[model samples]
Target: MIGDLLLAWISEAGNGTIADFRARAAWLARTENLDLHESATGRWLRDASALGHCEVDWKHGKWSVAPPVITRLPLADGLAVLVGARRQRLLRAIDEEGVYAEQARRLGSSRDIPPPCTILMPYERTRDLEEYAAALGAVYSGCAAAAIAALLGTTAPAKPTAPPAYDSPFEHLSSFSPQTWAPTLPSRPNPSEGLHREQVNGRWQHLLRREGGWYATDLSRGVFAELARRGETVIRWRPDGDHRTRTGTVIVDWGASLPPLQARALVLCSGFVPRFGSAAETSLYDNVPREIAARVASSLGQTLQTSS
Candidate 1:
């Protein structure tokens, strides 16, 4: 039950995809308040670990639940999600394959139940049919997964994949390079936006929601922060406008690259500055501060230009 509870806590923290020590400690304090008073709490953790219900990452000091065995089956022609009984047969079929499959139920588990099935494919607008499921049948599982067989498979032992690759969302600023990237502006919007509580992946993160947009991943934000530091600027969007419209997260276009960014971002070299927005006077050529422009280029924030 401890393992089950711990896994749930971990999952709930980061999009339910990851759990760290601080989160675990906090979760323990919250759910097992009585356990804290007992010295045997440590022994319980040891026992849980010995049973292979979970594993400890010593260096990082975190615990990780096993991830589901994702057996990729082409459902539709485009990406569509499966829900309810609509997702059952395929799940059962996959489960019958072997022990590596994840189960939907378990013992010694009061809270966390493993995911039954997860399918990703293109949507052809005809996926709901039972015939459709049987027709396009080239499914296989190549990923290293856990739960090792059983529909009642209780524990998920595999670790989640590493943080996604970093792609800067500020990749579009290269177009204005020939110019001074603009000379000046009346006010500059602060970049960091002063860290706020944000949900990332499936967990509670203290990062901004500059994302959910393609370029707003943690890696991108961190890179943006670094680049901003170099140029002494932070990468952020213009949150305020006449309509009070919420600009969805900032994004960099698909084909944009880094060279142009380097040219425009380097202060010492032949680079152009970036133009960002602010509270007071919005400038025609919003020259982003050196700090922020540098961060955008270096971090690859991949910010795009909107129509004037």
Candidate 2:
């Protein structure tokens, strides 16, 4: 009873993984009390394999191997190999003269891996299906798949095909050149405005949010420190007007969104000697030290005076 249920499940599934087969076995065991032991199931498969299979004949003397044959019937010129009620037709276009006859071709395999339950017959038996199936228990298999592969070369293994040369959509990006400019941070803001954070010499500070604008507070500090080094006490820092006020993560949330290059442009246009601390510090540009920068900050502070 378990074997019958197991065979039915295998037939229904067509092909399934070992896990799926085990699950089905457990379910059958629980529901029907029919325990299909894995070992028993394996033995049944082996027995089926020995009993018979199917085959196809590509051409006379040139046959296509099929599965183990359960039955073979001689047709007009060619033959038909049947395994478990499934029939494979092999063509033979030759006459009764036995001279060079027409060739025959087998249909493609019905399944991808054809389930371990089913085996693919070799090409030879299809020419004379009955004799070949009878000789199954006569020979053990050898390991020369390459020769078999050559015969089954209808679908060769895929090789890396040379890709056609095509231009990338962003190929023009290579033409873009990065602009370079000096940086100048303001020391004080028009007597009414001051740095958001204390100006520390030779150090990058925090980020700043002012007037609904996001500024790299570190860049501002570095600029101020550079100004101090040059004895430029009177300085003006102008945050870029084109930026979101929320402080965003450097590389992740908002790296490209911030106009670091535009900030450098503003500083360069302002005509102040720009200073830089190091390469790492200079990479982040967000504000310019200009006359309006100080004046605007000062005006804002006066309008909304903060005692802190």
Give residue 100's error in model 2 in angstroms. Answer: 35
RMSD over all Cα atoms, model 1: 21.7
Q: What is the lDDT of residue 161 in candidate 2?
A: 25
Residue 65 miss distance in model 1 (angstroms): 3.3
- lDDT (Cα, tens digit) per residue for candidate 1, span 137-239: 3222321111111111111112222322243121212121121112121122332222222333544332322322112223223334433324433223332
Which one wins on lDDT?
1
Q: Judged by lDDT against the true structure, how good is candidate 1? A: 0.29
Clashes per candidate, residues 3 or more apart or on different chains: 43, 21
For residues 173-263, what per-residue lDDT tens digits would candidate 2 score against the true structure?
1110121222223322221121232223432233232333324333323233222323433222323333432111111011111122222
Alpha carbon lDDT of each predicted model: 0.29, 0.27
Q: Among all windows of ten consecutive residues in candidate 1, which has the lowest summed lDDT?
A: 143-152
